[model samples]
Target: MPLVSVRQNWIVLLVFVALVLGIGMVVGLVAAPGTYVRELKMPDLVLPDAVSGILGLVLSVAFAIAGWRTWVIDSNSTEMRLWLATLILSWWFSPAFFIMRMPALALCIVAALFVLMVWFEFRTWRRDRPSFWLMSPSVVYIAYVAAMTAAIVAMN
Candidate 1:
């Protein structure tokens, strides 16, 4: 099979990233004031807004690093592209999970994402050791997902 041209692939990736971030920024702005509304009736919790925001930032950086590595260092292999697509689609659901406070559904989605992470790890481990670096964000994200799930379960 003929290889994909790097020029075309890079442009596509860049456009994808730009669109994701642009939508994210708009959502963030609209949702900024309502961070506490959903939990109004519940007891005051230790999970601070700043802390959640920081976590979001960390996730974003990790994702950007993984994307950069994928585009700059990895070849345009089918496996790599599949992993990228799954990661982005899964990530698109993440903020909504938090915004909606739908912890049960969030847990389910993150669990699926965790499975995807494991699959990605299995696929790339022997072939590319640095794939773990790309997959590290999943670790942090899974941790957060678990915590949020626990919190939601406890509140119910």
Candidate 2:
């Protein structure tokens, strides 16, 4: 059962958005995207930092919407929890490499995130198809991200 009335669940969506944007801000403050990333030999197809950041924001909102949709449908469902975990992992991808300066570790984290995200997508295929498709874009973007990270790990 939902812990709160269905009408009140919009708050959770805001929370997800704030939590994600806040994490991004904190990471920005600490990492600052200066010499650390620019000096590294990036992949040929690597996205510019500005473009990647914009996509990250867009993906974050996508995740928030998917999570909100799932939570409204069934707050206690296992898929809701899985979506939450996936969202958390999504927030950590950039930080794992950019902030901590661990490309290999970040690559591993992305691999795990990719697996978890795909699992979540499959889990929602029947449970909530819209939510499934809501998250579909991230799957492709994440694969691109993982390839880019893997290349960075190789080059560095």
Candidate 3:
């Protein structure tokens, strides 16, 4: 790889950003209600919902940025293949877990997904010197996933 040729692709970056924003909006619309206590009623509903929505938005954006960075920079980097696969799997699992309405199963899936994400981050960090701009989003994403998994497990 020539130093001069490693030019950043703004178009790809923008598309990735768009994907994150779009997915964030969709996830919020679909999964926002589930944040509240379902089986056991919580004392305060409004705060939970608001907090959840903000969390959702933040996670959604984080995922979007991570995906875009992965795609744009490591478009064909084999080192990133595992991370890419896990990210896609996590995304797919989300819908499946929710559609089935099985919190226990969703928890399992999310837990595994979080592990994979951690692995992905580890691999990425080791293979390349990703900037804070790239690494921060991935960290936030994993945290969000963990929080969501906890919330869902509690519901179950």
- The candidate maximizing lDDT is 2
Model 3 weakest 10-residue run by lDDT: 37-46
RMSD of every candidate to native, in Å, equals 5.2, 3.1, 4.4
Using all chains and alpha carbons, the TM-scores for the candidates as numbered come to 0.62, 0.86, 0.65
Residue 82 lDDT, candidate 3, scale 0-100: 54
Question: Looking at candidate 3, what is the lDDT of residue 81?
Answer: 67
Comparing 2 with 3 on lDDT, the higher-scoring candidate is: 2
Most TM-score-accurate candidate: 2
Q: Which one wins by lDDT: 1 or 3?
A: 1
**Scored by CA lDDT, what does every candidate get?**
0.59, 0.80, 0.56
Instruction: Find the number of clashing residue pairs for candidate 1.
Output: 0
Task: Pick the winner on TM-score between candidates 1 and 2.
Answer: 2
Task: Give the winner by lDDT: 1 or 2.
Answer: 2
Error of 3 at 133 (Å): 6.6
Rank list by TM-score? 2, 3, 1
Error of 1 at 54 (Å): 2.9
Q: Which stretches of candidate 2 lie over 4 Å from their true place?
A: 1-8
| Residues 1-99 of candidate 3: C-alpha lDDT, one tens digit per residue | 212122466676567667666764675456534533364332322246567568656755565556555665666865356555655665554554555
